[model samples]
Target: MKIRLLSGGVEVRGILLAAVVALGLSATTAAFACEGGSCVNGLAYEAFGPAPGTGSPLLAVFVHGDVSAGGPADYMYSYARQFAASRENVVAIALLRPGYYDRAGKRSDGSDNGRRDTFQSSSNRAVSGAIRELRRMYKARAVVALGHSGGAGTLGVIAGADPGLINGLVLASCPCDVPAWRASRGRGGGYASQSPVDYLSGIPRGTPIVAVTGSSDDNTHPELASNYVAKAQALGLNARLQLVGGGHGFSSGVGGAAVSALGGMAR
Candidate 1:
């Protein structure tokens, strides 16, 4: 892969290009819209905390699970609001349309529609842009990323693009091998052969990461979180794994724990 060094760090632009080619994704498919308290590109992002006041330490970017954006019922907004209220700059992003992955007979394009792939590709692009904007506009000292399920993979892609952009990551109930899951369901194009695990390998050491999983989360194996932690540890990253007592849905206590863990890292 082609590697370009910038400011003493390697930029894996070629890896992203290869990933796009392997997934059969068009570079132009990722579009964005930021308006009226909503930043909806591939994902819906909302910023909080006084519009980047005079001095802010960092910006926390949140990525929600497989759902559209709304309010407290929306996990993305919930976490973003929680962090923002806790004196941290925050931005919440919703990356998938409601029921985008539902295999039931509810799609307008029938069962053969390629919705998941479209959603993932678009979300990744939007997140990349959001990170760039956060750094430029807010002068964020570091970026703390919080992602759930498929959103975790989107964060993984952004991490690959600019590892230095992220100072900490919180992954809740993430499906570690998303590309494999998509392939098993014949949605192979959603991810490339180079998985997020491979991408994490290149991240700088001491980049703190927390992998949270539900003890009863059958949808995403708890082992998946452990695996990510293990990989991060192998790469010399400051990574930790936690198991909360709940399913895929977020619990009040678990959410607080995740935010606290990430906050400590950012500080």
Candidate 2:
């Protein structure tokens, strides 16, 4: 439930669980699309920067991995903080994927679907919509997405499905191949989920992609990302894989890798 960042003398010590939190950006659930006669604004996000829409050199959005129902959805806060703190010209956002509610009572709109299988195309639509809204609000020149585990998988799918929307992508411990990942766990996918491998042709050639996975992660095997990168590189995309010597969970090493990917953009 706690996020740890301990790379290069930078230590993110605490979680922002204040009941009365006040960020410059909108604190309410911000949804940008509509489906079935209802507004599709179920995504909640926390941001670090000046008010949205003024101007920023880089806009970075973070999405957390899937967890059990009602689990704390703030594990990616460190990534948000790192992106924001890296440069003054950056606006970093920690987005609660559709249907996720943090302990601080902020819930993003959508069905979490038991936190096991929320990576449906419908969910990606919601996420893409949210990112578009944030980009417009910030008038960002560059957009980068940083995600871990399931969040990484979703972003990987998005990179191919929605090209030109994001300028850079960082995926950590992702199960990019949905069917293979599910079969590895002995679970049949009764729900719908898109595989990043299927969308490789959709990615534009210039976009930069970085996927980092733990050496000891059994949940989302490193080969999953490795295979995805191999294909992406073969297709002329700027994608590479970094194997971290750890587990599947987020750590400072993951945070540093994200910073490396994003810091280049800030410059």
Candidate 3:
């Protein structure tokens, strides 16, 4: 396990390499929460802002997609940077280790043979730890969680465990039906049964959540994103789904739209 402290470009490179290696056979985890320190085996995250002096009441926590940690081409970071530049406090967090999606148990055929059923729970725990740490480090007027793909699932877990920790949630390209998805993947167990929608259903009304997905994201379940929005609405929570352009990965246009939506909610 290797940790990269936020500092110069060289350290970022080394940390990225370590994250890639750890994500072997699993999804890559990247976290950016607060700014400060370099602990052994633990990377320090920093927030970007305008003029390095102005501050805002909103703080956004961004979780990266599968096998990705805010590295180059990662839209999570791009949007976070944009928000920070606009004067919103933003923290990005990478996972402690690679996530299970990128790497599952292998089969003799040399294909991706790993089981997707059990990975969701494990990833959820990892993301929860990061969230707790970020909350402690930064006490903002409002907190929003932005997750894409596998990261969105992880955020669901966090919201289920503690809904008050974040003021709102944004799930992009998320597969809502965990049991069904796992089954479709040819795994015996159904989609990871643990989903935020299930837990948030009972929360008091007025919870804010937004689900976003691309019209072309074929990798995820067809109705999962819409289902999430519907569930949130049934619970009397403030929820909506946005349709964007592109596949699974982040695109500039989609990222901008997400950032805009988040800003609206934060205000």
lDDT agreement with native, every candidate = 0.60, 0.78, 0.56
- Residue 198 C-alpha lDDT in model 2: 92
Q: What is the TM-score of each candidate against the true structure?
A: 0.68, 0.81, 0.66
Off by over 4 Å in 1: 1-44, 68-73, 88-122, 179-194
Worst 10 residues of 2 by lDDT: 31-40
- Which is the winner by lDDT between candidate 1 and candidate 2? 2
Error of 2 at 192 (Å): 0.8
User: How high a TM-score does candidate 2 get?
Assistant: 0.81
RMSD of each: 15.3, 14.9, 12.7
TM-score top scorer: 2
Worst 10 residues of 3 by lDDT: 104-113
- Point out the higher-scoring one by TM-score: 2 or 3: 2
lDDT of 3 at 259: 60
lDDT of 1 by residue, 71-164 (tens): 2224456567667777744543332332232221111111112333322544455567667765676667778787776667667656755668
What is the lDDT, from 0 to 100, of the residue 51 in candidate 3?
Answer: 25
Over the stretch 1-267, how does candidate 3's per-residue lDDT look in tens digits?
445566674443255675676776354112222123511123223354422223434567776655434323233545676666665354433232222221212101111113233225655665565566555555455677777666677676677676577677877777666765556556665344376666675444565777777777766654777877787787678888888777666562455555667676666
* Each candidate structure's count of clashing pairs: 1, 6, 19
